[model samples]
Target: MNQSSTPQVPFWAHLLCGWPLFLVAVGGAVGGGLGGLAYGISISIFKTNVPMPVKIIAPVFIGMAAVVLYFVIAVAIFTAIQ
Candidate 1:
C-alpha cells in the first residue's frame, strides 16, 4: 500500500478545533436545558424545597457533560458496529 505524504490529524485536535465542537455544543445545550427543567420538576414534586436555581444548575451541568461528551463516543461506536 502507498502511504500518503500528508499527516493525519488527531481526533482530539479535530474535537477541539474542528466541526465536532459544534455537535458537542448543540448536544450540551439541549441536554442541559431539558435536564435543568426535569430536575426542577422532580424536586418540586418531591417537596424537598430545594432552591430552584441550585437544583436546575447542578443537573444542567451533569446533563451537558453527558450528552456533549458522548457525541463522539456514540459516533465511534456506530462506526465500529458497522
Candidate 2:
C-alpha cells in the first residue's frame, strides 16, 4: 500500500475552504446590525431624550466592528485547524 502526503495550500486557500463559514459570519453581522438599528430607531422614535441620528449611526458602527471581529475570529479558527 502507498500513500501520498496531502498538499499544503496557502492561507487564502484555507479561507476559501471555509467560505460557507465566512458567509455565516457575515449573516450574523448583518442580523446583529439590523436588529440593533431597529432597536435604536424604536428607542429614538419612542423615547424623548435620545437623539435619532446617534441612535442610527451607533448601530452601523457597531455592526461594522462586529463584522471585522467575526473575520478575525474566523481566521483564528481556521489557523488553529490548520
Candidate 3:
C-alpha cells in the first residue's frame, strides 16, 4: 500500500475560479437558491405580514450580488495569476 499526501482544496478557491460561463451559471443558480430560501423563511414566519418592498427587494439584491461577485472574483483571480 502506498500513501500520498496532498493539501485539501479550500472552499473559496474551489468555487471562485472556473470557466467563465460556468462560473456565471453557478452564480445564478446559487442566487436563485438563496432567494427561494429567503422567501420560504420570510413567509413561514411573517405569513404575508412582511412588507411589499422587502419581499420584492431581497431576491433582486441577492441575484445582483451573485452576478457582481462572479465578475469581481474572476478579475481578482486573473490579476493574481498574471
Best by TM-score: 2
C-alpha RMSD values across all candidates: 19.4, 20.7, 15.5
Model 2 over residues 7-60: C-alpha lDDT tens digits?
333454333222233334355754455444544443333334446575445544
* Per-residue accuracy of model 3 over 1-82 as CA lDDT, tens digit each: 8654533434432222211234324556654454445444433333344575764455445445545765676688779999
lDDT of 2: 0.48
- TM-score of each model, in listed order: 0.31, 0.44, 0.41
Local lDDT at 16 for model 3: 26
The candidate 2 region of ten consecutive residues with least summed lDDT is: 13-22
Count of clashing residue pairs in every prediction: 0, 0, 0
Question: What local lDDT score does residue 5 receive in model 1, on the 0 to 100 scale?
Answer: 62
Predicted structure 1, TM vs. truth: 0.31
lDDT of 1 by residue, 1-82 (tens): 9987644544543322222233334546644454454444433433434564664454445445545546656687679999
Candidate closest to the true structure, highest lDDT = 2
Position 58, candidate 2: lDDT: 50
RMSD of 1: 19.4
